[model samples]
Target: MDTPLKNLAIIGAGAMGSGIAALFASKGLNIVLIDPMEGALERALKTIDRQLNVYAPGGVQEAMQRIQVSPGLEAACNSDLVIEAVPENLELKRGIFAKLDSLCPARTLFATNTSGLSINAIASAVVRRDRFVGTHFFTPADVIPLVEVVRNDDTSEDTVARVMATLRFAGKRPVLVRQDIPGFIANRIQHALAREAISLLEKGVASAEDIDEVVKWSLGIRLALSGPLEQRDMNGIDVHYAIASYLYKDLENRTEPSELLKSKVESGQIGAKNGQGFYTWSPERRERVLREKSAALGELAAWLNGKAGGS
Candidate 1:
């Protein structure tokens, strides 16, 4: 399939939307970022500018020039592809997809930036379900290299191929998720690890700090170089089997959210955005952590690129 991705309409100006716009714009794709809320477009532009300065200071202006913010969905009618990054509300997404289906051309591909939502249910709101697919980008989308390209039962092969190609062209490591299961692949694995972490905390197995340090220095580093399945093989499958046989029953198997997490949300200590969560976050500490994380991801990206080039 040829790359039919050029003009992109990003329909949301929140963090995820703006970050996505910056990522594509930096790769020379003209973007129309649409949001109806007052001052949203301006805030998104500022965010895009700030992020571009960090990622590509010399070419910030060039990238900014490629982004055109608008206050309505009509501005996206002429786009080749429309990526909806709206808040993760099923009704809101359905409404947006319904409108876009009526306004956009028949050839335009529709993709969602949902972290873990039903892609088929979202596509049901549109007539061209074959053209709709999930393009799940991680938080801080500009820095993350992984993009989960998800396809539902009705999604066409051509749509999957073209969407993957577009992501690759935009400098992303696209992984094909063959099914429309909730959480897809990455989030399933991620939340499993998170559940265990929280379980340990609740059981007084360790403090949050120690638990994070253990993962960050051990499984985290190893997983970065080799995935879980590969690492298991490297460690000897017999060892894994022996451990799982004894420990699987003891692991956190609750289907509901942990009480600790529920309480944190109920108290409005959501995370870095709210200045509190598992760790207390002062303004300075939050900024420092954000900077450190961005820098670390940048370094990892550079190392991965070098390795790929060498190979």
Candidate 2:
């Protein structure tokens, strides 16, 4: 779509922002990495080079000239699309969009890399509400293949379809979400397992390792071949409907933290990002692990493509 998103701007030079910039540039798009912080824009560009070499060596090696580093909001105003990946805070995100709304052309598509924000709220800051969409990329965008293309009530069908096609051309799985709600589809399903896993830990039901092992060995295998909705049909809808009727409440967030999770997170056991969570590993080691996961997932994707009669 749109000739592989020929011009893209990733505003903000944070981790997610740089990752997004790298992904577009690696896909042979003209990319602008924008930020105002001292050295932030430069650092993000360097990080893009470093990350691309790891995520898509062949593509980035060939498309290394596609990226451009810029230090202000004005640099992104001319882009075809601008993806804001600033901090998780709402006011800051709105502020960026407000400025972008004033600066960018009416045709420029504005997207957010937010994980949990409401798409409607984000769109309110932009003038072209019909052109704004939630383009959520997973961590390390250049490597991760699945991108959630979200559309709220204000978004136009053309924008949604264009986003889907652009991402598809970039060689990513674009999951179309009909309705834009909090957490969207994958995250709702993700949090379901997360809450249950934490509950098991709090109740002394099983260690985190054992809990993860069970899911990874079983549900993970089934998911590898088919998604949850497909698995439901394969396993029989009657059984799923019965189970859903019985276990529906288990999916919701009943407790805030149960004190145990609160303590774990508050005490700096905030997972691999901080070298600890339920597991421990050095930051460098963790990146290596994630790279391995990316390679494995990429191979699976490639094989799946071949099976589906794709080159």
Q: Using lDDT as the measure, which candidate wins?
A: 1
Model 1 residue 90 distance off true place after TM-score fit, in angstroms: 0.5
Instruction: Write down the TM-score of every candidate.
Output: 0.97, 0.90
Worst 10 residues of 2 by lDDT: 249-258
After superposing candidate 2, which stretches have Cα over 4 Å from the reference?
Answer: 242-255, 308-311
Every candidate's lDDT:
0.91, 0.81
- List clashing residue pairs in candidate 2: none
TM-score of predicted structure 1: 0.97
Q: Pull out the clashing pairs in model 1.
A: none
Q: How many Å off is the CA of 15 in candidate 2?
A: 2.8
